[model samples]
Target: MKTAYTAALSMLAGIAVGAVAIEGLHAQSTPKAYVVSEIEVIDQGAQNAYLPKVTELIKSSGGTFLARGGNIFAVEGEAPKRVTIAVYDSFAKAQAARTSPEWKALAPERNKAIKVRSFITEGLPN
Candidate 1:
């Protein structure tokens, strides 16, 4: 009878451990995706400083630059252009990250030195 009780107790402990592990995994926060577009201003020489600053901003936001220098392959009847594409975890995460100390330092250069457009995009479902 004692041996049976010991085995039953072991089984219950194992089940409890498994439940805790599963719940912990589910509780973990998952990151999403954010897309950013940067358009170079007409005065190219003065705008060079912002590129590196924006780079630091992305890194501070729990992400990194996906594409720094994008080329204009075939404009299909559009003017030649230089562009950059960036991706971050999620919309909300990216928004929150924008207010980070690192981003705040980078923000001024973005507003005056260059023109940037950004939006959050839902990445592929997991």
Candidate 2:
């Protein structure tokens, strides 16, 4: 009876360890989300007014910019006037940032400043 009890306890411990290992691996492999924007400035004065406010909103929404209107050389197709790339920890978070109230509030000002084409994509696992 004692031997059987010991074996059962050992099996339970092994199962618990396996479960933890799987969870850890899943967490480590979770993919990130990237937001890419192609912008064309229409009104310089309006764009200047819109920049700071949008920047602040992005930062407040827990996004980190990978690129913000730097030099671009297109290999095949035409390059956009400007490009912006930001990354979030997860796809859900990225979507939330775009749909947030703060972002919505800035839309009119942003539209007045620039024409923007944007998309969100899931990145490879970290």
Candidate 3:
């Protein structure tokens, strides 16, 4: 959980930094700055343990968990798991958090405990 929160805080910080960068770029007539992260989490039968830790991590980082799988509206896969999508302010910060020591500490058990898919994207002005 601490890891997620760290990432979230990083996201918030990154957004703030991006805003500053964007404002400066605008002064020079540059493009806007933005970052997007799509994260998916899967666990067959250990949500009880996985969620609590993740919850703690998210809370610490000031991350808002956008969606968590609720009452089975539908099932398309054979895997029994849920998905959690969280949005951070920017890709840079999110990546930083993911690679940070705090998050790395959780790595030892993270892989065995759950499956995580993360996508980081930066938005360019059209």
Candidate 4:
């Protein structure tokens, strides 16, 4: 009887551990948010001035740049003058970063520098 009881307890403990591990794995697999910005610089001088400020704002908002305007070979369609991709913790955060007061404040300056088409999409779990 005692041996049977011990085995049952061991099984329960194993099940509990497995449940916790699964929960942790699920949490880690939560999808992130990605922001893609396609920009066409109208004024090089203005764009140069706006770059650093916008870059700093993005970094401060928990965003990590996956790509920021470098050499590109278009596989199909023509590419924009510049492309920037950033990943945020979640969709809400990504949207918030784009619509935040700090970002809105820069609209006048950013508009003067470049024309941008930006969107946010959810990323796949890794």
* Alpha-carbon RMSD of each model: 4.8, 4.2, 14.9, 4.9
Q: Cα miss at 45, model 2 (Å)?
A: 1.0
Better model by TM-score, 1 or 4?
4
Which residue pairs come into collision in candidate 4?
A: none
Candidate 4 structure quality by residue, lDDT tens digits, 16-99: 999999988876787899999999999999988999999999999999999999987888999888999999988888999999
State the lDDT at 113 in candidate 2.
Answer: 93
Q: State the lDDT at 99 in candidate 4.
A: 93
Name the runs in model 1 displaced over 4 angstroms.
1-31, 73-80, 99-105
- Candidate 3 lDDT over 15-102, as tens digits, reads 9999999987664542222222222444545545666776677556545566666534445655334555554545555566566677
**Order of quality (TM-score):** 2, 4, 1, 3
| Tens digit of per-residue lDDT, candidate 1, span 1-126 | 999999999999999999999976654544456565646575565577766666666776666667656566764765335555556656566767766677777666667776666565656634
Model 2 poorest 10 in a row by lDDT: 24-33
TM-score of each: 0.61, 0.78, 0.49, 0.76
Model 2 misplaced regions, further than 4 Å: 1-27
Which structure is stronger by lDDT: 1 or 4? 4
Give, for candidate 3, the lowest lDDT window spanning 10 residues: 30-39
Candidate number with greatest TM-score: 2
Question: What's the lDDT of the predicted structure labeled candidate 4?
Answer: 0.93
Q: Residue 23: error of model 2 in Å?
A: 8.1
lDDT of 2 by residue, 1-126 (tens): 999999999999999999999998877787889999999999999999999999888888879999999899999999999999999878988999999999999989999999999999999878
